[model samples]
Target: MAEEPMHSLARRFVDAWNSRDTAGLDALFHPDFRWHIAVTDHGDPEMRPLNSRLLHGMNLPWGKAIYNKKETIDIFSGIFAASEQFSLDLRTVIASGDRAALELVGDAVNPANGRRYDNLYCYVLHERDGQLVLLREYQDTLLLFDVWVAQ
Candidate 1:
């Protein structure tokens, strides 16, 4: 069989998340997979641009940037554990060679607070050998903060 195209691989990535299939995710991510979030200015004058490498393994109230496939799996596991319903709605996907960008709407209901967690996200991905090697995520930090605090 011919290999799947990059765009199809990107869609499968979201489908794996929506299904909360950890094993599926494990297969999709490269061994060195890294996930990054662009931190927005939270009105703190002292806050500076953070290096993505430095953010890995450091926990924040909202979430943590993660490195490696294991760490990524752990984060997803935690999210699924906390939310009764978690799903990603893919709005658009664009792929060029080994890179892809996805626009998504994430919806989840936190069981602890009974609050809806809804946010838009853009994920930029790099794939190597049919596995995702890097993912940069951009989302509404304020919305994330609100949902987290409510929970």
Candidate 2:
């Protein structure tokens, strides 16, 4: 069978996420999938403070550079569990060969604190055997801190 196209896979990924379908994610991700939280300050001055907060103030496991498949799935599961409504609006998708990039905005209401969780994101993904093998996600950490972390 021919491998799935990168564009199709990227759309499915967005759909799976919007629906909070962990089983769909399981099917889309390779067994050895890796996740990355893209936090860098070297190039973008706007990222400096957020990166510092994530690296120093958060002190959370998500601050780690890499996450294995189970950890990635678990983190998603936790987020879904915490929110009353969680969905992403896919803005753009660019894909070629085994690589894909997605631009999206997430909207959710976190029942825990009655706070609206709205954030923008960019995800770069690599595919292997038609399944996503790696995903690097960049998002607004300040909004994350405001909604989910701050008291």
Candidate 3:
């Protein structure tokens, strides 16, 4: 291996995800990968874990809910931005290689209540055949629910 650049690895996943091409997105994930979502305190030490790609991919409703997947994942190394809204902002700064990881930091401002939600997310990724095929992330699900229901 030529020690694939983190930017390349990150972009590969970001491009595919923003496109929301299930097949294309699937292409980036490891077959047996997992992810986690932590909702509450961004640094909440104790939280439930969730499957990365599988959970997100399995949500067919998002595709319908989202009018356009306009997002950006700035690539890095060992990680990628899994922080996107309905595929929007799919572009995430990530890290790649043996242990790809992505951290998403943002505020979900609910227009209804004018509440800016604080959130933090991390995606621990795994690759198959030189491609990211799995992911595990930690995020604020409560904020996610608030943001989601608002949409």
Candidate 4:
């Protein structure tokens, strides 16, 4: 077996996310991939699984009831971290043989209460034969839920 380059894989992940390609996102995951995260829920610890990660990530219904969203940020680095861009940060990225991980932080300010939510999100990836096989993601549900309040 051989190792695939990490930067290339990173590019693919970002490409999928920026394009909002659901299938492309799924293409990056390994079948056995698992995602985990610890979040605060009413002062209690809350954990999410792979299936839930994907399901919850499908995006809120854009049909009606909308709120303000921060601009899309994409962080990239070339020539080995010579430059840093906060807006486009990969969220957070970790890549190794047969495995890769990322955290996409989605933050916003609630107009109703003027509260800000900067959540630490992450995506766990697994691959085989140079192709993605499994993927899972984790994010702060409370932070996001706080922004999209129902009237």
Please tell me which predicted candidate would have the highest TM-score against the true structure: 2
User: What is the alpha-carbon lDDT for the whole of candidate 1?
Assistant: 0.76
Write model 2 residue lDDT over 1-151, tens digit each, in one string: 7544987888898899888999999999999898877774322212333346445655333546677789888999988887857998888888888998999999997677889977999999999988999888889877887787777
lDDT of 3: 0.46
Cα-based TM-score, every candidate: 0.80, 0.82, 0.47, 0.45
lDDT rank order:
2, 1, 4, 3
Per-residue CA lDDT of candidate 3, range 38-149, in tens?
2323433353444576454232112121111111111211012233332323335555456656665644455555656666766666566776544455566556655544
Task: Give the clash total for candidate 3.
Answer: 36
List ranges where model 1 is wrong by over 4 Å.
1-4, 40-59, 62-64
Model 4 bad stretches (over 4 Å): 1-4, 22-88, 107-117, 149-151
**lDDT of every predicted structure (CA atoms):** 0.76, 0.80, 0.46, 0.47
TM-score of 1: 0.80
Better of 2 and 4 by lDDT: 2
Model 3: lowest-lDDT 10 consecutive positions: 65-74
Best by lDDT: 2
Pairs that clash in candidate 1: none
